[model samples]
Target: RSPSYLAAQGCWPGRRLQGSPALSPFLSKCGTFPPESCFFSLICSLGSFMVMLVGLLRYAHVIECCGPSLLNTLGLAAGWICAAGLTMVGNFQVDYAKVLHYIGAGVAFPTSMLFVFLQSVLTYRMAKTRGHYWTGHLRSILSALAFITLVFSGVFFVQESFVLQHVAALCEWIFIINVLVFYGTFTFEFGAISTDTFLVLLKASQAPKSYKSDSSTASTPHGHSHSEGLAMV
Candidate 1:
């Protein structure tokens, strides 16, 4: 819908100025207008929320399977930050909030790449079966493709030529689609999750602060008990 609006206004792939510089038809550009901007904001906000939820679930799943670790913690942070960037990108139109929009783009792109890479590493580290190994291989390929496309998109976007700008936009679309596909891959692991997984996460989160000293004293045994109860999916 936003694309159609942009196309109607000759802003889908904007034209070059006769004597001035031209701007590429970025997805953000689609939200520069009135009605389309409304829809853009709505969609972006929803997507951002969904991304945050997915990140949380993934973090919880990892904790349930392998217990919490720095890598998983970093992955969770990266995912949430990426979601925040997406929220900024969607709510602030590039034409109106240029600085903030670019900032959002900067945060969203790199953090998303980081998220995928960390997830790929986690997949390999956690793999115990033939299927798990194949999943890791698939994730590695997606991560590599994401990195390449992201690099190309950034490189091409800064060029002075209109053709290069278009190429940048194409690369940007590919990068986004690739990331979405990577997220979809989580369905395989998610399918294995059980009620106990959620129960463990709930108990961990709800545990009283008064038990901190006791928990610390018995951390090793408690951790092993948790690991035994929360079987890997």
Candidate 2:
């Protein structure tokens, strides 16, 4: 039970639909709503964390490469960890959750994703003849500020109802839309990385090995060239 739930006294009996003309009409039995709401919070935390783990694992192929993918994975992994940490705070305390959330969702995740993009572009540019695009700082403070404003503003709406609720709902939707856009863009870039890496590894694994012979003839440089020519024939 989070601090807020504990603080709220686990659903005040008379307070079910209090102050709000909207939810009061549908009483919907008894104390089930509060428990259900708690369960939903748990699910959100678990789901977000699991999804973040999957994203990081996908980029784990570069463990030894010391390449752009390593940076891409690390930045994203940090973001997801921050997100998970915030969600955990939400499970235990509302204020703590909000504070952590503002940092994670608003500051960490988006900025981390921005780094992922920069690393990807840098690595990609390196592989390509035109390698100039890899030069900029992809994590922009302006973007982070916007996300922080949007995130905290939506979080501020959780307890709202009548008028305040509506405004909060609008902010919530705006935040969600922003996240969805980030999701789509990241998905595309991740796909490209996966496909490109797979193709490269596949080519390497399937390529013919250099010709070698067991006899002394194969040990000599001229013999190696002859073996190569013979293999081609």
Error of 1 at 187 (Å): 0.4
Give one digit per residue, the lDDT tens place, for model 2 in 84-110: 654643354333344544454444345
lDDT of 2 at 139: 22
What would the per-residue lDDT of candidate 1 be over residues 1-233, giving only the tens digit for each residue? 45566566565456533453344557887577779889988988998898888888888888888986799989999999999999899889888999999999899999999999999999998899999999999999999999999999999988978888888888888999999999999998888788887886787676666478677877989887889889763
TM-score of 1: 0.81
> How well does each candidate superpose onto the true structure, as a TM-score?
0.81, 0.41
Pairs in clash, predicted candidate 2: none
lDDT of each: 0.86, 0.46
Best by TM-score: 1
